[model samples]
Structures are given as structure tokens and as C-alpha cells.
Target: MSTERTTGPALVVQNLTKRFGERTAFSEVSFEVAYGEVFGFLGPNGAGKTTTVRTLGTLIAPTSGAATVAGLPLSADNGVAIRSRIAVMPESPGLYLRLSVAENLSYFAGLYELPDRRARIERALRSVGLEHRADDLCRSLSKGLRQRVGLARALLTDPQVLFLDEPTSGLDPVAAREVHDLIDALRKRGVTIFLTTHRLAEAEQLCDRVGILNTTLRMIGRPDELREQLFSKSIEIRTRAPLADPDEVFAALPGAEGWQRSEDGAYVLSVTDADTAAPAAARALVTAGADLLALTPIRHSLEDVYLQLIDTDVEAQQR
Candidate 1:
């Protein structure tokens, strides 16, 4: 999806810092959420993910720093203005048990003073595919549907940006998939989704760009960008030997790291770069008299790159 550049960023946080005495939750963090990008905010536990969002949401004042929402500077006079254009969904949006789904949605809509409120509630339920259950008590609904109602509440404002924290935490596989679908639909409609997730698959598939924040922002980019920058997006080879062992032949070749032998004694080799090393990797392995069973390039999956990014930060602190 093409994101239109905004008159200014959809959101901007500059030099954001938070501290509890000497225990700094974050230090001088800064980043921007553009007009129509689903930016994933992620980190390990206590890496200040929630702190950063709370600061931007104006739930708690930053120790020092500033943020703007939809071009309005974050100030006392405009904090309400900033919030008016944004929606914040906490990790757990425990709904009112007594209220029906429609009641719950209408309540939030009223809070935002949304016009044509009944029609908007209908649209929200339809958007999340919860129209069939719209009259059920929130407590009577399934966990996933409850979450969808929470989302529907957030959408009532038609906010330019939505901050979702662990929106699918307790759902089953099917439920998580449903929540994911909801998120994807919102992104397509050009609403910026700032999500904090332990669900790597969700982040990988849904986010256009991700910022791995430390006490400060550590790294930010599209998944592929960080993957290629931080790890080798290379290829692997697995082969069955015919007449000779691979090590005796491939051990001396340039760009070929040492080979690995599977439990069944097949050989697996790692190369520096797939495009550059594939031909040589192939020639060397084959000429070694090993039968090639599989030759596949390894792209840096989000799971792999996320570990690398988080680990790098952890190691820095350890040092």
C-alpha cells in the first residue's frame, strides 16, 4: 500500500525519556509514525514498549521530551486535541459485562461525540465481522469477539492513528487469526496501527515497518531491511554423499563455512551470500561427489532478525 506523505508526521516523539530514580525506562527516544503506515513497536519485556506508548498517548508525562499527534504539538492546551485524533487500546480492554455489544460500542462512540452514532456502530461491527453477535452481552461473547468490540470502540472515533497493545493476547488460534484479519483490514484503510506484540508472526505479516526500541530506539525499518542488515540472508545446501565426504573438498573453498552433517549423515552447508555463493557452493559440493538433496536460499525471517536485534542490545548492556 502506498502511504501518502502527511503535512507532517501522523505522530512524532522526540527525545522521549522516562526514569524512576536511576532506573531509566527509556532515554532520549525518538521516532515518527507516518500518515498511513502500520508501524510495529516491539521489544523484549521491560524494554520500554508500554512506557513509550503511554508517553505518546499522554497517559503519563515523559520525564523529558515531546510528541506531536497529527501535526498538533503535544502541549497542555493540545493534549486533548492530540487524543481527539487518536485511539488508545490498552493490553486488556475488559469490557462491561452487563452491556450488550451494541451498548458497549455506543458508549465509546458517545465518549468521542461521534455523529450518526447508530450508523457508525453498525459499520464498526460490520468492519470487524461481529454484526451477527452485536446484541449479545459482552460477557456472553467469545474472547475474540470481545476483542473485536474493543477494536470497534476504538474505531468509533475514526481516529487517524490507533495504538493497540497486545490486542490478541488471550485468544485461540482461530481468534488470533480473526484479530489479525481485523488489523490488516484497518491498515488497508490507511489508519496507522501502532501495535506492541509478542506475536512475531503478527508483527512480521502486518507491520510495514518495525522499530525495535531499547531505552532509546535501537533499530527501525521494514522487516527485510533489518533482516538483511543484521544477519546473513544466505542459502543452505543439504546433500547425500556418493563417493566422498564434503569436508575434504568444501573445507578449502572460499566463501564456504564449514559444513554440517545431519543425523542421517547428509551434509548441510552455509554460504555467505546466496546470489554470490550459490554457484560456487553448488560446484564445490557436487564436485566433492556428494548428491545434492536440497539447495535453498535462507531469507532472514522476522523471528531470526528480531532475536539478533534484541540480543545485540542485551549484549551491549552486559558489556
Candidate 2:
């Protein structure tokens, strides 16, 4: 329901770097976020995920390089304009505790100089399912509710780009789920979201693309693309009976790297191509007097890929 112009990418970063005195927070980070896309920024703590967000949101200037957010160049001269078009929800909700939910939102709306401030306030509250609690004092709300208030405040300006830094950090599972749903809804409506979090699963679930940052960018691509780049396709099959010499039997399958029995008793086969290997695996099993119960291609999880990359990087840095 935003009237903001949609042209090309919603955000673009080019070799962006930030530092504080002698310490470098992040360096040479670069990636672009397409309009209406949820771009997830992921890294371990101190990986400069938050620093990158701060730089892009115009909260802090990069030590070098440049970025254009929502078609506006990010610089000191354009900082005010850039800030106006983007809303940032920091890791902490940062709400005025004594103020009521409506009051907190109203204050932010006024800062944006929005016309019909009250209507926008109502809409923001409704968007986050806090309409019923609009009059409740922020101090009395649960942490989850306070987070929702933060989200509503972000919506006050109907920003073209929304930055959410650990939006669900401290909430219970139910509260986290609620926030996830709200984000999903916003994505469906074509709002661009820049999210940074330690939750790889959440990134896998919500982002159209993700960039793994750790002082520098490790990788940037779609979740499935990253998986494919880092792992081989595989297949898993359960048998009505135990596989006879699964290692040797499956090793003969097309592009097979041999097979191992999983803890669940399923034979997991590592192969170069599941498309060509699965059929051959089934045929080989049948010929070997094995009863194939179920055959499923192994899908690489985001966590698996993330850990592998992070561990590899850490080991290399140490060496």
C-alpha cells in the first residue's frame, strides 16, 4: 500500500567499508538488493552484520566506497533524504517506555512530517496486529509486544527500504513466529526488507537472496544457489530390509561417491547428480535383491552450508 516509486534495485552497496579508529568493523562489503526483495545479511557476532546495516541506513558513514539506497546516493549531502525514505528497527525496540503505543508511533510519524499522522499511526498499529493495544503504555507491554511497536514505528513512513536488525532476537517462539508472519506479509506486498540476524533458518525462509558477511563478504546468492555451489547432489533411500554391502552396492551407481547408513537406518548416497543417479541407484538396489521402500533426494540445509563456509574460513585464517 505504499506509493513509492519502484525502479530497479532497492539498495546497492559497492565495496562498502566501515571502521572505528583502529578497529575495522567490516571491509570491502558489496551486494545489491532488488526492489521488493528481502535481502538477508547473515554472519556470526562481531562479523560486522550490524555495522553494514548502520552504514547503509545512513546511521554511520562508510570509511570508503559508496552505496545508493532507493535511487538516492548515500552521502552526507543526501543523508537526510536517504534517511527519510528508509526506516530502521534496531535490535532493541528503542521505544519510549512511559509512552502509550499510539503515542510512540505518533511521535515518529510527526518526525516524518507525514500528513494525516493519526491515520498512518492507526495503519501501522493494524499492520502489526497491535491495534487493540494502541493505548497500552509501552512500559507495560511484553518484550514481544514492544518489538511489534518497533515494527509499527518503522511502518510509520511506509519506507521504500526497511532495515530490521535482529527483529526477533529476544522473543519467545510464538512471538518470533508472529514477527515472521508480519515480515512475510510485508514481502508479499512488495516492500523491500534488509534483515540481519544470526538465524540462518529465518534467512532461508524469508530472503530472496542472502549475503554472508564476516568483516568481508564470504558469498552472496540465492539460498539454493549457494547450496549448489558448495555441495553435491545426493539421494537417500530406506529399505524394507537392510542393504547388503551398501557401500559397495551403491558405489556402482552413476556418479556415486559411495553410500553410508544414516542413524535412522536409511542408506544415504553421495552422488554428483541425483537426477541421473537416483534411477540407477533404484535399479541397482532391485537387482541386488534389495526392497526399496522410499527414495528421497537429500536437500542441503542452509545451516549445513553456512557452517561449512564459516569453519573453512576460520581454519584458513588461522593457518
Candidate 3:
């Protein structure tokens, strides 16, 4: 777990597949995580997100395909080497309830055989803001604090690649925000993070890019890129009164592909480009003698893209 930086992708997966007996956990999944990038792994429950983390963490072997983790080839022989340079923080922190916070960390440090154990422990505790609670029993800590302890344990190795599985799965807003802040700080320090979570908003806010998986990778890109890929660019226009001949007005506008009246009595214009279409739409509205109340671009959230893709998968399976 040397802190020395590397020059290539922190992780590289090529057609990696895993199976349990006849059941396929995941298949033909491939992606790369760049150094210092926060790469979000998103999916619904039972979608093999954790399995993928475990496989990449060298906890389990893939059924087929290959991968490079922490700048080392993934294989039985290299498992030790790969693991030494990476850390996995599961949804549950899995601390010894009876052990004090510092004791729990010290136990794990021994497992890692990390030298300068005292200094590393201090630094890890400080990183997660748990230094003050070092002497407190883990059983007395809140769920959020325990999660921080788990994070501190993960940092004990000073991993090059950190895999986080649902880090804030059940945290309250206040606690989740604290974890979010810590993660943002880590990103600033250039720690490559592979975050798996069902929380779409968290992923959208924190991830540099995200990959949506449902047994297989459904999509992978930055939030905006995925939205543009899966949704049509559109502008929602609200007028004081409906145009008498909406079709006549919008049909003549450049960049507008089509128009529709929403159930809420607003006009939504499909466009090739919102920037180019907004001005044209405003001009068209004024010419039609309509007082425009609002002309706003429609933004699709990561949740929208996720649902659309997952729903499509469900429909395909039904067929």
C-alpha cells in the first residue's frame, strides 16, 4: 500500500464475468477507472454491484475475462499484490462491538502489517474525523460514526484504489452529508474511488462519471452525457395564454423538431439544441402575440435515466 503514485488507470476491467454455479452474477462487464477520479457504480438491488466490488477487490475470482487492479494483473498469484494496494469498505462497517475505536483500527492495522502503525492510525482517524472518539467503544457509536470508523480502517492501508459499497446506505441526511463532504475532500486529494450506491442523487452530486449496471452495464458516462444520450433536448414554455395556433408558430421556428402540449397545459418543444431553440422559441412566441411566462430547459436527472433503462430491461425480460 505504498503511497507512490502510478501512471495508468487505477482499475481496468475487460469483459469480466462472474457466476455462482448455474446462476450468473454478472456478465461481460467492462470499464476503466482513471486515477484520482470518483467513479460511481450504480444499480438496483441484486444487480451484482457488490459482487463486482468483491471480484475486483480480489475477494473472489471472476468466472471469465480479465482485469488489472491497482496497476497489477488480476490472478490468484497477484491477488495479494492487488489487495495490498486496494481497500473495500462494505455497507456494514463490521467492527468488533466490544472493541474500542482505536482497538478496532489497531487490530486491522496488524492484519495489513502496516508499518508506522501508530502514525497511520492517527492519520486515518484524523482523516475520518474520528480521532476524538479513539477511546470510545464502537458499540456506543452511532451508525454514522461506525461508518466513519470503517472508512478509517480502509484508509489504514493507504490504498491506491478504494472500493466503497453503499457507504451511506442508511444514513440520515445530516450524517449522509458529512460522509459526502468527506468523500469530496478525498476526491480533492486525488484518491480514486469506486463508489457503489442505490442513491442516484448522491451519485450525481459526487461522481465524476457513473456506470449503471443491471447484471450487465446498461450505460456509462458523466451524468450530463448519459442524459443527452437517453433523452431528447427540450424546453418547457409557459405562456399567459395558450397560442391559438401553436403548430403554426412552432413549426416555423428553427432548431425545433416537434412540439407537444403537456397535461399541465404547458408547451414542451423538442429541440436539437436548447440554446439555439430558446431564442427562436421566444421570438416565435412574441410574434404569435403570446406573453411568455417562462421558457426553461428541461433537465433529466440521473434517476430518470436509470429508471428508463431499468424499465426497458424489465420489459425486455417479460417479452
Candidate 4:
């Protein structure tokens, strides 16, 4: 079954909620993923990350909300249609140990009842750079090789949207990087990917935008945007010696909102604009007759953003 291209967002979810009896899996979650964009879904364990994927994937129905997956309304009636347009690659590929790489893909192709099965299988294997291993038994392949096979299976349908749940769960750095490269390749091919992972660095590196979830939608934006939203922009100034009168030097500086001295005798200035503050601070130090060592903007990683929100939730629960 071929999936026709759709115009609008690849996925649209509005106030989506899911509850299992008394336990709420996720509540009032909403987000959209653009076609050909890699949208990262991030959260800690038991934070409804998987549940959100399962819900959006149509494996489980939402309790009270509307969603459109692959341009089709998310409903029991559209389940088959939605499944046809999207593919889900779990952490484990779940291949038969006794089956050869080609045989495993052949099995799934049969399930999808795809046409030109041989041609599709060849293309899928080639996409993941596993054409050479088609004859190798899955059990004999390394974990990383097995992962490539899983990805190949996901591509057999040429899905409009691909959901990858921890695509690099457990592997050496080398193996993990291999999978990252494949994702990069797929993104360049204009494949829309919905990636769910606990690895903040991976999300930061791969996703165009990311949503941090904790039983609810906590935040959603580009990684840098999230950092700017949650953190104040600041410039770090290191000097050969502490300023003679730090307050006097930085107090009247343009674009600087506030200043603080670090334990290691560095100065950190909260700035409205680094472009404006950096040069001004440099001249201020020279005028004060202080030896300037370094002046640079401090950058916060996505992990910092993830922890800040998740930690806030923990503190609230404690209270």
C-alpha cells in the first residue's frame, strides 16, 4: 500500500488525553510535526513518553481529544489507514532469530501485503546500508546490525511519518553513531520522523524541534528556543585577576542587566544582548586596567532544559 503525500502538518494533536482506569497515562497533550521535520519527544522514565508515542501511533486510543495522523483523523475507522501511512520502530526490532535479514523483511512485507515485495525489500535494505547483509541470519548479526535491519523494516512502507522509540537504546558509541547517520540521511531525504528518546544529547543533535513531556505538555520549541525561554542569556568573563571594583566596572555597562562574580574569580553578566554586551564589557575591563582573559556567551545544552522542567515537577510533588 503506497501512502499519498499530504499537505499540512504530518501530525496534528489537540488536547489529547489518555487514561487507564484511575491512572492517567498522559493528559491534555498537544503538538504538531511538520512534514520532513524530525520532531523529538523527550521525557524521563514513566513520564508518558512511550504512552504518547503509542497513543499517537494509534496503538491505543486517546480518551478525550482529537488528532490527525498522516492527514487522517485518528479514529478506529482510520486505524488501518493511519497505520498504512506511518511506521513505528520500537527499541527492539523483534525479528525472528532463525530468519535471515531478507527473510525477516519478507515476513513484514507480507503482513503489509506490499506490492513489488522484492523491489521494496531491496530498497529498504539499501536505505539502511544493509544490502550486503541480506543473507545473514538476524541472530548472527551484531546488535547494531540488527538495528539497521529494524530501520530497514520501517522503511519498507515508505511511511509518511516514522515513529522511532529509542532507536539507539543500548550500543557502543560507534554503533549508536551509525544509527544517527542513518537518521540524518533519512531526514535529508525529506522523511518526517517522530523520535522519542531519553537521551537529551541525541535529541539535541537530531531533532529540528523538541517537546518535553511530563504527564502533560511542559514545553515545546526548538532546542535553542527552549534554552532561551528557560534560561537567562548571560556572558562569562574570565580575567587574569578579579576586577579592582567589579561592581563599578559592570554596573553601567550597556545591555547588561546584572553581574555576579564566580568562585573561580570569573565574572558572569546577565545580558539582554551578548552582541552588545561583549564588546562593551571588553572595553570596560581595559579602561579599569584589568587584564581580560576571555569573554564569551554561555550556552546551555538541551539536557539542562530537560532537567530543569523534570526537577521542577519533582519539587512540586514533594511539596
Q: Write the per-residue lDDT of candidate 3 for residues 50-83, one digit (tens) a residue.
A: 9999999999999999999988999999998888
lDDT (Cα, tens digit) per residue for candidate 1, span 181-227: 98989888888889998888889999999988767787889998988
lDDT of each: 0.80, 0.88, 0.92, 0.91
Clashing pairs in 1: none
**TM-score of model 4 (CA atoms):** 0.96
**Model 4 scores what on Cα lDDT?**
0.91
- The Cα error of candidate 4 at residue 319, in Å, is 13
The full ranking of all candidates by lDDT, starting with the best, is: 3, 4, 2, 1
Off by over 4 Å in 4: 1-3, 315-319
Clashes of each: 0, 0, 0, 0
Position 230, candidate 4: lDDT: 95
Stretches of candidate 3 off by over 4 Å are 315-319
Worst 10 residues of 2 by lDDT: 310-319
